[model samples]
Target: MTTFDKYPTVIVSENEKDVWEGSKHIVKQLKTVALDHNLIAIECYPGIDVKKLYHDVIQPLNADETIYAADLFYNNHTITEMIESNLTEDDVFGTFSPHSLEEFLDDKKVKAVKEKLKSNQKKNIIIYGMGASLFSNESLLIYVDIARWEIQQRLQRGMPNWRTNNQDEQISRKMKRSYFFEWPLADRLKKALLNQVDFWIDGNDIENLKLISKEKYLQGLSQVVSQPFRLVPFFAPGVWGGEWMREKFDLDKDEVNFAWSFNGVPAENSIHLQYGDCKIEIPANNVVFYYPTELLGNKVYGRFGREFPIRFNFLDTIKGQNLSLQVHPTTEYAHEEFGAHYTQDESYYILHAEEDAIVYLGLKENIENEEMIKELEEAEVGNKDFDDEKFINRMRIKKHDHYSIPGGTIHSQGKNSVVLEISSTPNIYTFKLWDWGRVDLDGKPRPIHLHHGLESIQWTRDENWVKEHLSSPNQLIAEGEGWYEEKTGLHELEFIETRRHWFSTIVYHETHDSVNVLNLVEGEEAIVESINGEFEPFVVHYAETFIIPEHIKEYSIRPHGPSEGKTIATIKAFVRV
Candidate 1:
């Protein structure tokens, strides 16, 4: 009737190297398994990649096994209850060796006969684990094959068309996702477990986890921690799947992240731990949307990719495709004209391109009121009838072609070209001023929003914008040691910047004061660093969000194994003034 009763507990050491070796022995001993070993209750270790562990050790041994990363479920509840409900004060204890779960189900263990078993027989041992699903190569091959096809199918037929079938192959997927794998809902993970959805370790060195921290304490905290981060939510048309996002986490708009309950259970998060504690709450809009919304329209994947909150989408048009010449009202204009607005300022930081890739920035360069009105009428009709005309002036674009679209600038990605549009969250409030007859897959022409488009259009076209948008981005002494540094003198000190951030096996140092919003335009690194001494690595992707807070500079980021001789491109945006 105490914290340690009812089960034969095996507390492994909190060391990776020790755990890896201990694992070889546990797999061999578990063969004499009984019913209470039924739960095979497992623990996750820090920096341990569970998937790889099973691949090398468990599958070949052919034993039932389970694995969990303390990080992902650090905010999960069912996992906590699953662990706590099984614990009591009278349970017998053992290390990573020959232990018996028989004590829990009321069975007694026979005394040892003082004979030692061979540890290095090299026999094929049976391995069992919760993470077994991802460990076996056979299972991964099947999952990956199906996933690739799924992406292909959605791309070719379009998601909308796929949704109209009662006999859709994804119906089983729906049944499955209905219970587990849900975002914005705690029960999602619960359902996943109920559905027997097995997850494995997703990194290297995971082979050494069970031997590390036997700290069942963090597992206890995993249930109560506030897993806060911003997101935007939505669903793709024709598909029942929805996406969620929390992009604009205004200091004014949010209080608590969109709260969720899991597996028919209430959140175990203490009311006091809501938003104030953990000195490192990533920028969340007081909402717990599982991911970002699907707004990146026109063949581009939308927002839900980043684990971090803020991400920048860069679009560069190569050919002369009239960029559905749409305009966006400024934050102020958005409210007055459309009745709703958020922090939506987008810029076109253009690079090299052909001359004909005329990016129709705003209205034509230098024209009259009559001309503006006349162009609008013609542009609208063209979009209706699919006519390509010279309604907007063409910028003779060349190499290093650039433009800054601060909200109201009407721009589009032309065909056969390239561009980098550094913009705010892709919340589509684009007032389409013009598009020359674009049709959907249904053979129907897309509707053009003349009224909204015109309201947000930047009427005046200054001929010298190319000069204004272009800046010689340079580097200054970056604030922190080991931090990437490059200073520049462009727009009144802090306008726009393209920075180079690298994983310095050579220069990877530490910093504290300044925060860098890195847009990984170049390479990738597992940015595992500590905010207040807690360590976890959120991946830095090609097109994803990753933030290093101002205070948590005492952290280290090492490349994920193959990260030896690689370089990456990053566009850093922050207030220098």
Candidate 2:
């Protein structure tokens, strides 16, 4: 029998009510099984005496927990020796201080961690009980990209003995530097403790995140808002722009702006061509002046791009029209052909859809690959027939049904479909497959680029194509575990998956790991607690997402809101294995 199947680790708890009850229980259940190797944690009140229970046998688990553990994996003996003396001794620091997670600038202690959680305004949770686990003693941990850089700097100065695990296992050197170079600087308090010497984290990165459009920002205001409007109780006109102009954009701009108004354009307003809802006005030019050019560069395209925890396209269906059946290029696809930094792999979580609304997935079964090829190749002329649509197969899809679209997959939305299109932040690259043979008053076939679409198509097809998975059948609210792993879609070029939990959960990790993009799927009332306070117990609304860095572990979350509140969804996107 395998170690886990044989010697299951055991979890013990003293303060049963310590909010992380689910995680606490799982830890206990692990002990009964036979496991040769694994990390384990156990806590019971301030001093319950685990020695008496496990004293009969030598605990073989890799992890152990107590009231006074200073690195159980590296320093368990210290905790054991102290426990023999007294329960009220130095052990308290090991069991209660939040410092065990990270050294806080305020105070690297458990009580401080608790205080931060209690006062956290983001709407996280309170950790009343202590929980610990020694799991994953054997894990390959690699810090990559910016997060990796920060860890490197800290390790270089703070601890001298630290060294690389395997110098040769390098992450792809070409992720095309992300705006992580623009992450907000750590608070003044944290800066003091980290003491990153001469750590010039630049001053202008903030500009990239500044909200730069008001007219374009209000693209969908007509729906959630009323006409002949007053921006008071009806709709509190949200300032559409970033708050950290220089820090977000790293543009070094003093301020950012995105305010514009439009009536009509004189066809020749500017040099660049204008499309639906986009143009430079004239006569009544009435520039909704987004003042700063740094802000203007992005505003020119309106708020179609964003950064941070994530960047996505927010579609407001004030005017609904079937976007040409199209496919997006994956990050890899972008890099291979056009070269893109942001990812194009995407999925649609229906925010709001008409009852009878429909969405087209891919070709239905029985359509031969050669037929698909022939259809695309011989499609200059058209008539009204299913065969005439030479694009995505139109089908009715409604609320709550998630549509997973990997790159190179032919798909599109039909009439009356408004969705939160969550995907990579590249904000560029969409290959148009086909558009209904309709044109604007100009009578032009909108626009077609089959060359680009062909490059984006995933040739491989499974018998069961267009699989729309239903989310939360029983609302299997995770009691407490590392994470719920779900593999959703597969692509010849890429694959997609999601790791989510309602209540905050503890996910143990080893040194080598992967950074996951986390998008909040539901329940605006939830908080994700972490070792350091970067992820405070805060509230998140629908369509929101976050990133979980690799290596950090033991963070837990609790649902807010009056109901049995918890994080609704933390969808993850990763390269397929």
The alpha-carbon RMSD values of the candidates against the true structure, listed in the order shown, are: 19.4, 26.1
Q: Where is the poorest 10-residue window by lDDT in model 1?
A: 261-270
As a whole number from 0 to 100, the lDDT of residue 35 in candidate 2 is 45
What is the per-residue lDDT of model 1 for residues 331-383, given as tens digits with 9 covering 90 to 100? 66655643332434555434335545555554445556566666667756763
Supply the global lDDT for candidate 1: 0.34
lDDT by residue for model 2 (1-577), tens: 1100111111112222211112223224333331432222222111112233233211332233222222222233433243322222221111111123222112335454345433643432211111221111231110001122223322333311111122222121111111111011121212232211111111111111111122332221211111110010000001222221112113224433211110011110111111232221111001112111121123322332212212233342312555557777656666655434445766665545776666666665555666665665555345332353443455565654456666766776664555555554443366655565555332444445566677667655322555433222223423446345443332333333444443344432221133244444455544455556533343433444333333342344445453243435444443222
Per-model C-alpha lDDT, please? Answer: 0.34, 0.33
Highest TM-score scorer: 1
